[model samples]
Target chain A: MARPFVPTRMEEPITANHREARPSGAVDTRVEGVVANWFPRFLANGLDYLDVTRILDAIENWDQWGTTWEAAGENYEKLGRDALAAGHSETAGSHLRRAALTYQFAQFVMTGDTEARRRIHLRMADTYRTAAPLLQPPATPVRVPWRGIDLVGYLRTLSDDSPLVVLIPGLESTKEQFSTFEPFLLERGLSTLSFEGPGQGETWYEHGFRDEAYVDAMRALFAWIVDRPDLSGRRVALLGTSFGGYLALKSAPGLPVEAVVDIAGFFDLKDFDNLQPVIRDNFAHFMKIEPAEIEDVVSQVDLLGTLPLDVPVLAVHGEVDPIVPVEHAHRIAAAQMNATVWLYPDGTHSCNNLHTIVRPAISDWLADRLAVGA
Target chain B: MARPFVPTRMEEPITANHREARPSGAVDTRVEGVVANWFPRFLANGLDYLDVTRILDAIENWDQWGTTWEAAGENYEKLGRDALAAGHSETAGSHLRRAALTYQFAQFVMTGDTEARRRIHLRMADTYRTAAPLLQPPATPVRVPWRGIDLVGYLRTLSDDSPLVVLIPGLESTKEQFSTFEPFLLERGLSTLSFEGPGQGETWYEHGFRDEAYVDAMRALFAWIVDRPDLSGRRVALLGTSFGGYLALKSAPGLPVEAVVDIAGFFDLKDFDNLQPVIRDNFAHFMKIEPAEIEDVVSQVDLLGTLPLDVPVLAVHGEVDPIVPVEHAHRIAAAQMNATVWLYPDGTHSCNNLHTIVRPAISDWLADRLAVGA
Candidate 1:
């Protein structure tokens, strides 16, 4: 008989920011923070109901949270393998997707044990790679040549003639989450290519996060897109969510993109002190510097009056957003010569509270701008 | 210039049940009872964010909640029509679907007003019929001949040779909600046909809710399915949600089906008193009786040694289901000689809490049982 599934992570030591205690300068109240951080995933089918239940059950104390998620992920991954062996590709895809989500959540908000975090991250990427091919239409893996390294991406297409839209994920987010957003664009006849650039996903291990790394990497990705014979688009739009939104706007002036979509993205680093501890720490880790040094690094980041005037822009932001304030949206929109701004009064970070409206609207805008299928 | 949209409903009188005060025995504690009741609709894209926000802003003390949704719905329907005129079929479909959702919510819990409810219901059905054909794969409207009347359904097909699974919606739910569930089955080569039978959708106006109407309608639907040349399948399966779970299992023995999938359905009416007021009221409205008479009507509902022994079964239920008790799953499973029961410990009504796991598992089970792709 197979041995019982057991996660092999060493014990984490006690720290000042225990799960029970509220971290200093937390963006939201504990309950809201917990729900807001994970509820979107549940809505996106990134996390299963059972996983949410387990997390909710251990709401007050979360010392075992990482280990619990890791074990569940491993078990789901095993199930996926078993289903694949049985020639049930659909079932395997479902299980593996869930496994990837679980693995991603295993390290969510966890800042300890770099080796363990890396192990889980690798497992997530591997699981996603294996499962993406089994999905309907299938996601073809891409390796764009970078400086002495390679940026990884997944190209999901309905046809070779379809227009391309490059997706940029934000801090602490991976391309795996784009499964939720891909279908909307695909249905509109726009193929999507989402990748992990410098300081994002697996590439983060090689190149530490810099505020400018995102735009630089996007430029390299655009270069790669220009050369790909399989991809059919002379000019592509860049869509960035959260912090990636900044990258999309920043790169628009430099790249051969027809349009740019920035959703709940930051325009200035002036509000660095206002961010939640978790986000601040994650950004600092990506910058390979202490939290204190983050302000100085971010001070150099700004998009006021820097965006290309020719590029049509769609910017969506929530007034009540805790991470990137609503002012960032105003700044970006003001700087752009041609821009459409959608401000949600009761929206959270990323305008997630208004996803049903914004997602379709964004897709419509992209399709219209790209003249996809025309 | 295009004429501005205007709703035709007159002003409503103040009622005992306002937005702030919960009707006796209401479940949720929020001031916005109506919004809380259907917030998930917005989350699922059944309703638009702007519409929902409009409703919430005017929700301090609603005297015309039904009219509010109806006006919002009419505005969206107008938008849909305008989009269609502009040669944007995809946009038209989305708008129409959202319009249908808004119209559905208009009369969701308005049991006291029958004429308004029927009018809104007709609008919902009409909009869905128009939008269904615009969707990818397209929904072909099917009218199965019933006793002196025609039962309405939408046949969503991927291929002519794919297996068929008929979907049954529960109280206050419609085929529109199945948009989320159908893709899973279709991915595994099983076409879906979601319909309104007896006390549901368009059929409800013709034949008011009768305890036996669901089974009777299913019988008629099966007969039609067997004869349709456009659809191919020797035998079909029935999958039902909420109250329809009872209908699916109850009709399984008599219908010419190969399998049944019951998600969070009731086994017996013994626990009728434990239900929430809104659900009980809706049931009463469907039955064309008073809330006090519902228990007597439901008392006739039970399944003991009634399910077929030959057909395989899949039953999913939430342990903490607010509407149907977990014991119903136990009783239903016990009665069936071959049954698989998945009871979620911390699940809500319909095990919606466990949708990621339950949806895929049910799809796999149905595919395996009917040999859909084989």
Candidate 2:
């Protein structure tokens, strides 16, 4: 999402202890604006409106945004811990799970200081892992070796024979954000594998986002899925949002994917110089490289080179998506041998504004493609 | 509940066919204000924030509130029906269940015309029953004969031996609103019986709220549970909110209830003249009685005469509750032989504002009392 008008990346992440030397009004206004627009996205993605409302209300100081959210997350974490002490496993699981996602958002786009962001990200992962076993369908942590590091995933199955839906989070999103969407597929008897590729969530500290490395990670991941006796025979679908959508298509050509649901995916990459500075800066932050290197990375993230994927694909996009243009969806559908585009005319990024209808519809579409029930 | 507000009851409920003669601006503003305050309650009781936001945003005409919500409910119902036709049972069940609650809220305070409110209420009941069998641990629609009519409740059990928690809704709430709270108990090896006594939901039009009838309904409900061989020997907890809390305490004395949770229960009924007209009118509307009779009705709905019960009681209230004061919790606790006052200093009516913590905590407290797992 290349949206404009708020939260420019700073040279250093604002820590709990000090105020960054930036103009407070400008930073606060922009951040508040971003927060205002993301209400629909946050609610659709599983952040309780109450939680979102309270945290946003409490974080009047934009410099302390991360640490403020971190404190609120710790409150939930303590509540979860108390529930666990009382032997209320489900309550513990739900609260701790909420804490994980809270911590995830606490660090989201705080790329001003990657070190601080990574530390918070690691805590999110730990909280998630702690909640994993207590979930209704317990999560199975997945680790595939890549670039001398592990590409991380959390798999949750509904039943032994359930089909698989591999979910990929967006540029700033992580595996934890799939908590809301996972239910739509899970309720349809489809298991889910929510993963973090290179330069995402867990491994971002060590492994940077590289075009070739992303493809390699997917390659390794697919192979690992095949090797698992439990997941071998099941049909599979790939679903990714934003940047993940671009990568899903970029990687699907040579992979064993049966279907793909790409939300706001990219068909052609914009020139780094022509793109918004905020976009370029975020890319640089995510890539762990300089802004100039972003051009090379974008050059490799295009779908043109990997044309004509035979797998069924559903391109879901928002016509008014603040970031990627809706033209990308059209371009993507046009290039695919079998594809359809479901674009919401007045939707924001991810059609999150239309989530009430779109989420179930996409899960239903995936269920149809995989012949899940039948 | 007794706060000052805008909405004054109309002589007739607004109909889809024609607009009633009402001041649009005043009506709309007041209704909007009420909606503004109900966010935590709505989310806490299972309304998706997106749905609530969209519906509230769309309803500029306060006169059309019922019809507008009714239309939204139908849309979800159609979606649920389509999912069912496509064999997505779980998705269908969830959507339909949502539709039921949507329809329930559609008529929550639309007491302008008892006939119209009853019609929408029936639709909610039908939709809920349709979705019930598709639900996990499928809800059993219970009908016990009373006053020459069948009393209503929906029972869902985790297992053959799971302890039962009987959930009673607030003054304007129905059995369907229990959808959100049921999960806490269900997730903790407890069964739930969501009931609508004499003047609650489906039967409100037929049997008015008489103090004797209210007590008799609980007696009949407890007896019906005893007769079920499937639920034999299981522990039972009674939980009621707002007016339901008053009813629960007012009726628990001679019943076979092992535990009771009274959230925002009234310690003493204020004089009808002293109560806010909105609250008085709403109570009158719910009771289907003349406002003049409210004083006599309030006289009979107190816990003073029936106290000193040996059952474990939890009086959960807010220190600054808008309706029943925190003193209610203290008074209830004082009257009961074994009781605890969980008074949140800043909680709203029914402690709905603190639901995320209060709801699970109450369920966990009940679990501990019932010896649910050991």
Candidate 3:
């Protein structure tokens, strides 16, 4: 572990209502809708090329998007229910999973109205729950208590002897998107538990958004996993993507975790003011506050006292990441001597553009830390 | 079956010395190297992202390319051989296959010198031969006897009762690149036989190049597959890419095959004169003929008399394909009744840009025809 390096103030002035003043070309329309979602959509499609192609075929532009996904979700939902009626459990499970993913994507970028987002997210969660029992080894639902409410999650068992990895979704991501990523961990002898802690999916409805709520949720999750009869492993790892990366880092300090993966996460909140409006709007909406109050809460978010995580940390960031600055990775590495920071020269935010490289490396890193296949 | 549709002459004149005359930005330097070879390189890297990234990181431009791959091949070759010496057969097999692929890519686009091509091709073949026996289920090398010579190939078995599919490589492609594509076929419970016929790999060293040689080679391959006690498929399907697409269509008539998959292949030689110089020169070099003789021989290559294939056909092509026009797909479908032509509106050559759509559809179509998964 290295000495804690206090972060410096912002180099540029933080503009008020920064979203409107930001350059239009920063996050191009194509990048916002299609390109940014390719890997995630591929995951939702169960890595099936035909299904992905079919999705792409329906929507030619952003204007014709929402209904296509809704229709697709309905189609798959009908197919799944019909298959279940026909006693084709395997086929029903696959179709229902597809339906859940389709519903999730429909609400992926949807914000502004809580009622619509809640309706769509509830459908996504419900469909996933229906399909979970038929999944190989099955994903059992778990509710970890936080204050008076409960945080929703799913524990996907690989084996009792396998290491457990808690999957934390980003601001826009939900537990439903873990269908593809969960397999990588499972194949490497890791049990995956995906859940929305705060400011994500259904959890956003109850807990709203607070950075500390995520840390509290992780603590509760760890406690629950330790007590489960089917689950083993003294220490668990937190695998977080995007904003979830920040949560993983926040929870890493004093948390009983063997490893922490912060993929395109933030080291400091100094860059929060400079983020795109789409991102800023979503964060503010999740926080259950007006856009103006975002800066005050975000400013309180920093890794000032958090350092020397001691546990192995893996930070992957794209050098040209438009969403999260690459400097965050550098700062994380500088403050933590045991951190392995991989900065891709041509990668975008989350290095989703470089999925082929990032995905496998993360899996292998976690497997090594967990001593999988040993 | 629909009546044969004779193709009309080109509406525009073919350009002479087309390489220099073509638009400057058409095939950009980096795109010319990378985009054209993504699939092959993806295969060479064993479909591993880290391996591919390592190869990409080593090179700044195309000029300093060949030696890097040669060194990489040598490195893997040494590692594989050492593992073999230590009786780590599985590890050795995987590395040797990687070495063979690296060697193949080293000579992938090298066209000027036959000697260099032969040297690299030999190394690729030798390494693969050593690794083949160690592959899961093993790829048995079969020498299909041709006129006064032999065509080297590998028969990758899935099951004795499974239908066999013939993998015909494109002009620049060879059997070495089938490492990834073969799995798609095998997973569908189909056996794959990837071979180098005339104008491809070692076959070009011995028999030179002729369109008819491919048909002859397929005939020999079918005979061999039938005679093998371990192989029990009544019929075989021809799945070809690029020039192999053309060959698949050419051999579809009177060939004892269950189906044909012509991906981005052309129907007539009328468009040959209008092709890019890199393509024309490669064809001339393979044919061992003057560039002027290319058009004459190519002009004779048309599907006028050969049509109404009594088998299922899947023709996948990009609508805006630069190399082979999309109209070729339409013409092929018009001439053949039992044809499923998929034209991707925004796809590039061979529809590689639309691989997610094209690859799965072809496999599913072939599987449906062979009744493999039924």
Question: Could you list the chain B TM-scores for each candidate?
Answer: 0.84, 0.89, 0.84
> What lDDT tens digits, residue by residue, belong to model 3 across residues B231-268?
74445799988878888888767667889998778788
lDDT, model 3, position A334 = 73
Question: What TM-score do all the candidates reach, one by one?
Answer: 0.82, 0.91, 0.71
- Which wins on TM-score, candidate 2 or candidate 3? 2
| Candidate 1 residue-wise lDDT, B125-181, digit = tens | 889788998887788888888888888878888777777898988888777767668
Q: What is the C-alpha lDDT of each candidate?
A: 0.73, 0.78, 0.71
Instruction: Evaluate model 1: give its TM-score.
Output: 0.82
For model 3, report the TM-score of its A chain: 0.85
DockQ of each: 0.17, 0.15, 0.08
User: How do the residues B1-374 of candidate 2 rate in per-residue lDDT, one tens digit apiece?
Assistant: 12222211111111122223334554565576557545567777777776776676556676767887788788788889988998878778888998888897788777677677878888998998889999887888888887688888889988777899999876788888887788888877889999988778876867878888989988888888889898767889899988888788888888888988888877667544666555666788778888677778777777777876678788777776765666667767767745766766657677676677788888888989998866
Under CAPRI classification, how is model 2 graded? incorrect
**lDDT per residue as tens, model 2, A1-374:** 21221211111111122234344664476466557546677778767776676676656566777887888788788889988987888889888988888897888778687678878888998998999999878888888887688888889987767889999876778888887788888877789999999878776777878888888889899899899999888888899998888888888877877898898877877645665544566677778887666677777777885856788888888877877787788777667745766777667788787687778888988988888858
The true-versus-predicted C-alpha distance at residue A223 of model 1, in Å, is 2.9
Which model, 1 or 2, shows the larger lDDT? 2
Off by over 4 Å in 1: A1-57, A61-86, A211-215, A232-234, A270-278, A290-296, B1-88, B211-214, B232-234, B268-283, B289-305
Screening candidate 2 with a backbone cut-off below 3 angstroms (N, C-alpha, C), the clashing residue pairs are none
